[model samples]
Every structure is written in structure tokens, then in C-alpha cells.
Target: MATIASQVVLHPTVSQSLKYGSTTLGRDKAYRAIQYFARFYAWYLLSKGDKDAAARWNALKTHLGTARKLLRLGKPMEHLQAALRACLSTGPAVEQVTTIARQISYFGYLTFDAFVWANSIKFWTLNPETSTRVAKISNRFWFAGILFSIVNGVTKSVRLARETKKLQSTQKWGEKTLAAEAERETRLSVLLAAQENTRHQLIIDLLDAWIPATALGITNLNEGALGIFGLITSLIAAQKQWEAVNGKK
Candidate 1:
């Protein structure tokens, strides 16, 4: 989760500092961060070191003692194996009497545990002959991949959640606009259909009439057309005026 938290906590500046640690300023920042992390980790570890923790730790050590005693006795290999086997069948009480047993027995379990811890910190890094301060420092920063992945996963989860919120909001707005447009198109189509019907009826009446009274004469043709246009205009104006008057009321 530190990776995600780092996003809002000045990661660029930190990365820059890490990259530029050869410089005095970067070195100072690294020192400060180290001090902070160390203090926090110490407090966390100390809190976990309770009475129950101590008891469990001691019990495990006693289990190791059971294995050590078998080896120290200089028994035959088969006898040693039998002792380790006996510890397992004896139950949890014998958990401290020997090492863990499953399909395989742990060889040199105590030394192996030490080696594993050291490997986690760049094991074999502090060789008596060739070790340097740089190796020691690097070891401290050699974090387990699992722990690193957890931090990254947490950060990514938070980002994805935020992105999802934005995507949902955008979708809602688009849907609302689409619905309103659909309604408007339905209303417009209805109005256009009604006007088209009225126009077709008017044309049919003029075509069917035998007299052709108003449009047949060339001299009256322009005047009739002008009158028709004036009538249409006046009808529109009257409707607008009625609407305005009604609005005032």
C-alpha cells in the first residue's frame, strides 16, 4: 500500500532523491527516510514482542533442542531418524521436542533458518573476507517480493476504484443526453407528420376542384400566390401573438 500512498506523498521527489543520492541533498533525504522507517519498524516489532510471542518463540526453541539432543547422542543414522519421527507422532507437546516433520525432515533446521534470514538481507553478503559497507547497506533494502507486491496491489486497487467512479459518471451523463434527444426527436417527428397531413389535404382540395377559380387566370395567379403567402405569414404571427398574450396572463 505504500506504493499507492506514495502517489499523493511526493513520489517523484523521492525517486529523484534516490537517483541522485550521489549528491549531498539526496543523501540527506535518504538518511531521514531511513531514520523514519527504522523508528516505525522498531515500534511495530516491539509491540509484537508480547508474553504470548515470547512463549511461542521459546517453545519452538525447545523443539529444536529435541533434535539437537538426538544428534549429540551420536546415535546411528536410523536411530536419529527414529527420534525425529517419534517427536512428530507425540503431538504438539513434542513440537518443541524436535523439528517439523512432513514428508521430509529438515536438515540442520537452525542453521538453515539463519541462512534464510541472512539471504533475505542479501544472505552471505557480510562475508568475513570480502564484505563492504555498500553490501551491508544494500542488504537492508532487499525487500521480499511478496511484501513489495502487496504494497503495489493495494495502491493499484485504489487507483482503479477512482477511475471506475469517473467512468460511471461519464456513462450516466451520456445516457441522460441520449434519452433527452430521443424524446425530442419523437416530438419533432409527430409535429412534422401532422403538418405534412394538413398540407397534403390542402393540395388535394385545390387539385380536385373543377373551377380552378383562383389559380387558372394568369393575371390573378401572382396575386393569389401573394395572398396565400400573406395568409400563411399572418397565421404564424397570430399564433405567436396568442402565445405571448397567454404568457402574460
Candidate 2:
């Protein structure tokens, strides 16, 4: 969906090892963040949606989300190419459409990375003053990214620990209390679900400045990150064999 990646190519970066290394670390952080979101969204959708939508997105949402985030960050196509290679290496016979999509998007991410980085370097190279301005802004953004991750990670860890403790305590109580608690939980979950969706829409609106329409993918509403890609590849392989037998019959 992104117009930029359509023309991007990723050559191996043996020339500038230091720059490449720093960039790779940044890319990895961004990739993991996206992957976490994707996996979460895929699981959320799978856990929340109808059977059919779940069937399509439940598996690869996490992986795809990572790909989407990396692409948005303007990471290199080499990373994406490697991911695609890894996904396809499992087997050509595998027919997971989502795997294929993830593979294609991986390529898409690479293309995006190459294009953005190439332009960024060129602009900076041709003009030191301009480069300095961009560099300053980029440094601030990078620092912000790191700070955001640290704060978010700590908050989430604490919240999860509390929620888990509550879940555990919920199991120790009497039936009447448990029933009332369960009903309260159901109400709270539903309310949280609505609030979450509303918050998510606001995020999508804000993200549009960075990601555009097409590259946003389906993550605006979904959940899983890692397991989906594996499921997709497995299912595709299974479906291919099924089709092969059906065609013969």
C-alpha cells in the first residue's frame, strides 16, 4: 500500500559498519515494539472477533504489526528481506495467505526503509546545516522513543502483576461472591473493551501523520504478534495439501 517501497532496493551494508550497526539497533527496538503491538492486536482480534475474521488475522497480526512498525520507522529493507526469507524458507508448498502477505509486507518494509534512509542520507550529505537540524530533531525523537519504551514497559509490568494477582485471588472466594465478582468483571471487561477501542481510534488518527493510510495495515483494531505468522505458514501448507487432494479427486 505504501508508494515509497515500490521502488526501494536493499543492498548489503558492508560499507558503513558503524552507521549500519547503530541503525540496526534502533530498527530492532522499533521492530520489537511493533511486533508486540501486532501480536497483542492479533490476539485481541482473535479473542474478540467473529470466527471468520479471527481465521484470517488471528495468526499473523503480531508479525505483521512488527513489519508495519519497522516500515513506519524507515528501517532498511534488508531486515524485511531477511524476515521474508525466513518466512518463505519454511516451505514453498505452504500456502498461508497471511504468510504470503507477511512475506510481501516484509518486502514492502525493506523497500520503505531503503527509500527513506537513502533520501535522509542524501539530504544530510548535500547540506550540513539542513542535516544538523534534522539530526537534532531525530536525536530528540530517538531519546523520546527510548524513554517511552522504558516508562511503558514498567507500567505494563506493574499492571499485569496486579491483574494477575487479582485473577488468582478470584479463584479462592465463595460461589456467591465469585458469581457477583464474575458479573462485575464481565461488565468491567466490556467497559474496558469500549474504552480501549475508542482510545485505539484516537491513536490511529494520530499515527496517520507518520504511517499514512495503507501502511497502517489492520493494526488499528487487531492483537497478536508472533504466533500468527507460524500459524499462517502451517495452515497454508495444510491447505495446499488439502487442495491438492481435492483437485485430484
Candidate 3:
């Protein structure tokens, strides 16, 4: 039993999980997954007339949200740095423009969100009206950021598709061009991989957009639906982060 326990403690998966969870983003994503799950389960319980249980889950969700806010206290500056970097990076014009816009929007959102967190913790006080205004502004910026991301993804997908088609049409018969063909194949593979990544990010952004839309009163989706959407996106993001941390493809 001791040997078995030692083996479990020394497991590669366990070590990888520890590494992943060590990052602030990883911890926030884990908490977000739980928070959204709690939201959904609370709604489910309430629908089943389990008010007491629902309240417990609701409290858990709220606390997790507060914790995540605290965890992200310094993230606004990170977004600002990202925006600056985006502004300097060269890419397709549409992509570069949208990337800069998206990063700036996120910087705005997170900056306002820091205020919201402060208000929540009574670090500073804002009147009810002011608080509501700030929250709405943050949500609007978040919505705009997601919109820009979707546009960037769509534009990139189209460009990638065109490149892929052009590459496929370059093949010729009975030529001593093995090296050329091999290079073309490698380029095509990279394009396809990029296309897949763009599609995945598009789906995640699409799902996440609804959250801010509902907050902005543009959508009337219930907590249950929003919770499920958040949970899905969080899991997808977490999976990507896990792969990155583990150096896996």
C-alpha cells in the first residue's frame, strides 16, 4: 500500500497537473470552471424546487468569482502590454487591426473590472448607480473584444483556405521536384494546423460572447444557459493551457 501510494505521488500526470495549476491563469481557469458549474447546478437545483441546496451552490459560485477577481488584480497591465505588442506586430492588415482593437478592448474591460472588484471588497465605495454604470461599461468592452476576435478569426480562416487551395493546385506531373513537393506539403500542413487553431478559438469566442451579451441585456439567456456556455469555453481554454504547460502538441 505504501509503494502504491508512492507511485501515485510520483506519477507524471500528477506532476504535470501541479505545474499547470502553478500559474495564475491556470488557477483562474480552474476556479472559473467550478464557478460556472456551480451556477448551472444552482439553477438546476432551483428548477427542481431545492431552494436550500441552490442557495449553497449560488454562494459557492459567488465566492469563487470573488476569488478569481482577486487573482486577476494585476491583469489589466498585462492586457495593456499585450495591446502595445499587438500595435507593433506586423501581420495582415485586417488581422493586425483587429488584434490591436481586441487587446485594447480587453485592457479597458479589465481596468473597469478592477474597479468592480475593489467596490465588491469595500476597498473603495461607488454609489449604486455608478457601480452599475461601471459594470455595464466593462461588459460592453468585453463584448467588443470578443467581436473583434471573431472577426480576426474569420478573416484568418478565409486567408488560410485560399492559401491551402493555391498550394494544392501547385502539384505538377513527372517533374524532378521531390524537394519542392516536400516543402509545399510542409507549408500546407502548417496552414491546416493554423486553420484548425483559428476555428477552435472562433468557437470559444462565440460561446463566450453570450456571457457579456446577457450581462449587457442584449440577450435574455438564463443563468443555466450562460453557465453551460462559460463552462464549455473555460474547459476548452484550460485544455489549451494544459497542452502548453506540458509542452504537448
Candidate 4:
């Protein structure tokens, strides 16, 4: 019983985020981590002797499972947040518990964005030395895109941690402080939008204008395919951001 409780406390979902060094393989690992979190959370609940509490946890787990399925279905972040809210409503009704789950979920989202941008860079940077000027320029843009994404992810995670600390210290939230935090979050949102737009513009310039105008036009099939891939990925990302800003699912 003690061992089981220790395992519950030490589960990756309770505290784990992808590190910076191995981001190239992050997508696969993130998927595994999500799966493991779900499995362990399930096992933990089953190990509980309190039937009532286990029932509540089971319901929360169901919501989490729905969230995972919705994510796989390409649903927007709002849907995921809704599922998270359902889980939160079920139990452990503590602010600290809420903050940890919310932050970890956001971290997962950022990890995915990082994965896509990293792949974009990899594809763009292939054969960089022998690539045409257009390809080279696109690679630079991809680098900026990935860099901004990493910064955004890290900063948001840090902000969450700081807020959690403040919540713990205060032991309660005040309206004035909540308002200030909301405003700060809004500013961060604007920064994210600006950086994303800049990256999108660079991608458009490369794919629509620069590539066509360059004398060495798409020297190989692979480069063309990768460029198209990057464009699609960027467009999808931009669309999701727009949806988020508009408060849509």
C-alpha cells in the first residue's frame, strides 16, 4: 500500500515535462508519456480502497480519456480544456491540484508545436550547403519559428510555476491580483500571435514569392515536398492560433 501511494505521487503526470536536449525525438516520447500517465493514473485509482473516491477518480479518468481521443481527432484546444474542466470538477478540488494538471496539459500542447517546428527545420536544413538561395532562406525562417516556439513554451511553463508558487504563498486568490494576471496573460498572448505571424509571413515569402522568382527553381522533388509540408504545418498552426484567440473550439 505504501509502495502504491509512492508510485501515485511519483507518476510522470504529476511532474514531468519534456527536456530541451532531445526535442528531435520529442513527438514519440511525448506520445509515450501521455499514454503512461493515463495508465498509471488508472492503476493508482484501482489501488484505492475507498470506493467513493475511486468512483470519482474513475470519472475523471474518463474525461481525460475523452480529451485524449478528442486530441487525436484534431479537435481544438478548447475541447481539450473542456475535458480538463470536467476532470477538475470531479475531484481533488484543490487549487494546487488544478494548477498542476492545467500546466502539464499546456506543456503537452507546446511539446507538440515544438515537434512540428523541429521537423520543419530538419526538412528545410537538409543539404543546406548545396541548396538554392530560396531553400537556404526558408531554413533560416524555420529556425526562427522553432526558436520562438521554444521560447513561448518555456516562458509559459515558467509563468505557470510562478503563479502556482504565489497561490501557495497567498493561500487564496484576490480579484485585483487575478485581474493583473489576466492582463499579463493577454500580453503574452499578443506576443505569441506576433511571433507566429512573423514566422507565417516568412514561410509565405519563401514558398509563394522567393521560390518562384529564384533562378534555381526547386532543384529536387524532395525539397518541393518538404516546402509544401512546412507551408501546410504553418497554416494549420496559424489557424489554430486564430481559433484560440477567437475563443472557439
Candidate 5:
């Protein structure tokens, strides 16, 4: 047991505790050491005038404060892990709200195409023979894609909100149990959002590629510029969406 213990690796701060002190020291000393390290890091960031980092540091202090309390009560590793897991599982509300806003804005852009396509009569003024039929068909396809996107967003938001509410209600649960519950809900939300995002991408592909190609076939110049713009914006939106789901910046 002594040989195995000698080979064990703790985090740098934890290892520092053992180096500076001894194993016989109370666990509270370990907790205090960790707390002091976090506070110093937070202070360094604040001194550099980083408000965002400072806020994050404050939140970390809150989480570590909880951990320190748990250690003082002599809670086991399992309880400590649970508290940390719950703290890390949360994604800010601002992120989700921003995503929803972008989705709505994309819907508005598609609506612009819908309006252009619906006015097939204007196309007839440019070319009397084929423009009218082509315009009507193009309008129908754009409208269908737009409507599908709207429904997808609304349903996904409602489902996520319901699940989030259910998760929030478990705040009073025991440490281990609440951690498991929060992790489960977080995973479920990600999966659900991912599935819907896939569907949304399909709709966007139709709008950006298919409808634009059709528009170029019918109206020529006016719709061509819009198509190019749509393609560019769709690519940007796709990158953002992918990053959001993958938990990247």
C-alpha cells in the first residue's frame, strides 16, 4: 500500500499541499489551499481589468465555497464530485437565448425569399411565358421550408424549457442524486437540440441551394444576388450552430 500510494498523482495544487505540509494534516487544510489558489487566480485576472474572467472567477469561488463547506462536514469524494459535476453541467441562459434569436432572424431572411417568390406576377412582367409558373412553384417550396423551420424552432424551445424546469425542481435533492439528475437533463437537452439542428440544416440547404437555383432559372438577376447572400449567411450560421452544439466558441 505504501508503494502504490507513493506512485499516486494528485493535481498540482494538491501535490503542493503534500510537499509543503504532511498527509496527517486535516482535509480542511487541503480545501483551504485550493480556495486560496482560486482566489489568487481571480485576483490576478481582476487586476488585469478582465471583467468577464472576473465574473467567471467569482462563480468559481461560489462553487469552491460549496466544496469547502462539504469538506468541513467531512463529506466523501462522491459528494464532492457530485457538487462539482452539477456546477459544470450548467450552460448559461444567454447562450440559449442568443441561439433562439439567430434562428428567428434566419426565418425572417427566408421570409424575404417567400415574398419575392409569391409575387410571380412581377416575374410575368419581365417574361410573359414561363416566369409565372416557375415563380409560383418556387414560392411554394420556399414557403414550405420556412414553415418547417419555424415549427422546429418553436417545438424545440418548448421541449427544452419543460425539461429545464423539471431539472431546476431538483435543487433540493441529495448531492449524488442531484448531480446525476442535472447531468442527465443536460445530455438530453443537447441531444434534442442536435436532432432539431440537423433538421434545420436540411431546410436551410433547400432554401440556400435549391430555391436559389430555381430562382435563377425563373427571374435571373434580382434573385441571383439574394441567392449568393443567402448561401454566405447560411454557411456562417452553420458554423455558429455547429460550434454551439459542440460547446466551442
Candidate 6:
């Protein structure tokens, strides 16, 4: 029993989890999953006429959201730096432009969101109308960022498809002049991996876009649907973060 306890305490999974949760992004993703779950559960409770239970879950969701906003206080600068880096990186023109635009939009969103957080905490109060306007602006920027991301993903996917087709055709050449078979295979593998990543990101962006869209009054999805979408995207992001923390490919 002592050995089993020791083994459990020293487990690699436990260590990996600690490492993952140590990062702000990782913790935020975890909290986001719970927040959205609470949102959905609250909606469910309300539908069943359990106002008391629903209010509790709704309060949990709201509190987690406020905490997350606090956690993101320093993120605007990160996005600004990312936008600068994207400007310098070399890629297809469409990709380069969209990446930079997306980063800049996120920078704007986070900057405005910081003010919203401040208002929530009574650090400084905006008039009610002004606060609502600020929140809407933040949502608009977030929506734009996600839209840019979707555009980038679609463009990249198309380009990757073309490259993949060309590579496959070259492989069918009768002579061995087509690059070494091993090298060709390696390239194909890389392209396929990239395509997969792009598709995964596109799906995430599409689901997340609805969140800000609804907030901005561009969509009318209910809290339950929005909660489910947010939860799905958060889990997908968390899975990637977990794999990164654990050094898994």
C-alpha cells in the first residue's frame, strides 16, 4: 500500500498535469471548460424550472469569466507582439496578411476587454451605456479575429491541397528523377500533418466565432448552444495544450 501510494504521488501523469496547470493558458483553458459547462447546466436547470440551482450555476459561470478576464490582463501585449512577429514572418501573401490582421484584432479585443474587467471589479466604473458599448466593441474585435483565422485556414487548406496534388503527381513519374522516395514521403507526411492542423483550427474558429457573434447581436444562439460550442472548442484547445506539455506529438 505504501509503494502504491508512492507510485501514485510520483506518477508521470500527475507531474504532467502540474506542469500544464502551471501555465496561465493551460489553466485558463481548464477554467473555460468548467465555465461553459456551468453555463450549459444552468440553462438546463432553468428549462426544468429550477431557478435556485440555475442561479447558482449561472453565478459560477459569471465568476469564472471574471477570473479569466483578470488572468488575461497582460495578454494584449502578447497579441501585439504576435502581430509584429507575423508582419516579419515569410509566408504566402494571403496567409501573412490574414495572420497579421488576426493578431491585431486579438490585440484590440484584449485591450478593450481589460477595461471591461476593470469595470467589473470596480477599479473604475464606466457609465452603464458606455460599458455596454465597450463590451460590444470588444466582441466585435474578437469576432473579426476569428473571421480572419477562418479565412487564413481556408486559404492554407486550398494551397496545401494543390501542393499535395502536385507532389503526388510527381511521385508517379516513371523515372527515379522524382526526388528520392524517402524525401518525397517525408514531404507528403509534413503536408498531411499541416492540413490536419489547419482543419482542426478551422473547426475551432467556426465554433468560437458564434460566441462573439451572439454577444454582438449578429447571432441569436441561446446560452445552451453557445455553452456547448464553447465547451467543445475549449476541450479541443486543451487537448493540444496537454499534448504540448507532455511532449507528445
* Better by TM-score, candidate 6 or 4: 6
Q: Please give the distance, in angstroms, between residue 226's alpha carbon in candidate 5 and its true position after superposition.
A: 6.0
Give the candidate number with the greatest lDDT.
6
Off by over 4 Å in 2: 1-125, 176-249
Error of 1 at 162 (Å): 2.6
lDDT of each: 0.38, 0.43, 0.93, 0.44, 0.49, 0.94
Q: Give the TM-scores of the predictions, in the order they appear.
A: 0.18, 0.27, 0.94, 0.24, 0.31, 0.94
Candidates ranked by TM-score, best first? 3, 6, 5, 2, 4, 1
Native-vs-model 3 lDDT? 0.93
Query: How many residue pairs clash in all the candidates, one count each?
Result: 6, 23, 0, 0, 0, 0
After superposing candidate 5 on the true structure, give the runs of residues whose Cα lies further than 4 Å from its correct spot.
1-128, 175-182, 188-232, 241-249
Winner on lDDT (1 vs 3): 3
How well is each residue in 1-249 modelled by candidate 3, as lDDT tens digits?
Answer: 999998999899999999999998899999999999999999999999999999999999998998998997888788788889988888899999998889889989988988999998899999999999999999999999999999999999999999999988985867757898788889999999899889889999999999999999999999999999999999998998898898866
Give per-residue CA lDDT, model 5, range 26-75, as digits (tens).
Answer: 33344444444455566667768897987786676556545544333322
Model 6 has an lDDT value of: 0.94
After TM-score superposition, what is the CA distance of residue 229 in candidate 2 from its true location, in Å?
25
Q: What is the Cα-based TM-score of model 3?
A: 0.94
Instruction: Report clash pairs, candidate 6.
Output: none
Off by over 4 Å in 4: 1-131, 172-246
State residue 165's C-alpha deviation in candidate 1, in Å.
Answer: 0.5
Question: For residues 125-213, could you state the per-residue lDDT of candidate 6 as single tens digits?
Answer: 99999999999999999999999999999999999999999998883547674468878999999999899889989999999999999
What C-alpha lDDT, on a 0 to 100 scale, does residue 105 get in candidate 2? 47
Stretches of candidate 1 off by over 4 Å are 1-57, 61-114, 117-151, 170-249
Query: What residue pairs clash in candidate 5, if any at all?
Result: none
